[model samples]
Target: MRRTQLRRWIVGAVAIAVSVLVFLVPFAFILITASKTTQGASLLGFSLPDKWVLWDNIVTVLSDRNGLLVRAFVNSIVLTVASVTIMVVLSAMVGYILSRRQSRWNGVITFFVLAGLIVPPAVVPTIWVLQRLGLFKTLPGLVLIEATFGLSFCILLFRAFVATIPRELDEAAVIDGAGPIRLFFRVVLPLLKPVIVTSIVVQSVAVFNDFANPLYFLPGDQNATVQLTLYNYAGGMAANQYNLLFADILLITIPPLIMYIFFNRQIVAGMTSGAVKG
Candidate 1:
């Protein structure tokens, strides 16, 4: 028994160490590159800068060619926040109905939602559809698209969580003269705390880091997002400013990274609670 436990502990420690090293290596590389100067960067040196140009690089990246980075940053914020908002509301409503109301169409609605998981997005066709709908190349349009993609998974999460909540609560609220809206807001909704937080954290991260939808749907330097900003920077800035490019990458990574670090526990708890309860 002692030998088996010892072996398990050793293996677990090794696995954890390996995982941490794997994560740290790329992060270290990015930091080294981010801190390198134009000349030092050209030499492809993989150490901290002899003279730190991080502030200079930041100022340049943000101000270069009339503040494209600033615009991109703002665009990213808008896209992420707006999409998450729409996704949360729409997904929660759909999930509530699916869980509470046993309509004949429940299975069909579920099948259609699950279909979103399997059906690969027809990017070109989707763009065409967007154009036809008069929704192309705009932030609101992009928000709707992202929300559509995110809705299914979020609905599943919410439905699963809500399934664990008792129907008696709804009945009790109704007995107390509560309307459907009041029961939802005052009674049923409050019990969905864990899953809602889970949805917010998960969807917020995804929408913030989204690359392709923004690239294909909303194409313009003026509306460039953080991920798209890198493409523009890499193509325009060239090798001499690769360090600055690295700086730009770091800038874009910070917000999501900070959010995750602070809320990681909340995310884990929320997801686990919802999944287990439902």
Candidate 2:
């Protein structure tokens, strides 16, 4: 018993050490660097700022290029909300259908869904298609791209969780004269709280933090997402504005970090529910 307890304690300590080194340490470094002067941050040392100016750095970042950072934040919020909403609704409907139905096409549909997870997006082709559709460099275009890219994973998550729900509820709903839409919305969706929260939190982070997609699909300054606005500090004054750059990174990172912190338990529960057998 003593040996078992000692081993558990050692493992727990090791995990804590790893977590601190991996997450907390890098965050501390960012905080310290973001607090420093231009030359101090340019040095990129992990030590504390000689003269802390964190608020000034934050203000400069926020007010730079006529409040570009503010615009980027609004664009990101809109993109994340629209993309996640589309993903949740469409994926949930598809997941419910896939879970409840026993069609012969299930295997083929499943193959394509799995393929979506495996296949790297063809950027050039996607760009060409978007241009043809008059959506390139548009927020709506980028929203669609984000939604499409995230849909497969969300579908799989919803599908797995849907399987855990008893079908007796479905039968009862149908008996009560509920239509297909009514059945799903009134019955299944409410019970999908865990997976819905999981999908929203996970996909919101991904969409908000997405750099490559917005860079490729939405190029204009007018449509800049928060991640793309990082380039504002990368040229001309790059050597002198590392502090502002880090401050911008810190600003954009906070929303997703707060989401994860608040929903950590729900994420674990949702993921575990999808993992175990119904």
- Worst ten in a row by lDDT for model 2: 232-241
Give the TM-scores of the predictions, in the order they appear. 0.92, 0.98
Model 2 accuracy (lDDT, Cα): 0.93
- Candidate 1: residue pairs that collide: none
In model 1, which runs have C-alpha deviations exceeding 4 angstroms? Answer: 1-12, 43-45, 236-240
**Which candidate's lDDT is highest?**
2
Q: Model 1 — which ten-residue stretch has the worst lDDT?
A: 232-241
lDDT of 1 by residue, 1-278 (tens): 99999999999999999977897676777778878788887776667779877788888888876988888889988988888888887888888999999989999999999998789788988888889999999988899899999998889888887888889988998999999888888888888777777788888889888889999999998888888877744775474677888888888878877887888887887777666766
The best candidate by TM-score is 2
How many clashes show up in model 2? 0
What tens-digit string does per-residue lDDT give for candidate 2 at 1-278? 99999999999999999999999999998899889999899999988888999999999999988899999999999999999999999999999999999899999999999999999999999999999999988989999999999999999999999999999999999999999999999999999999999999999999999999998998888888899888988777574688988999899989999999999999988888978965
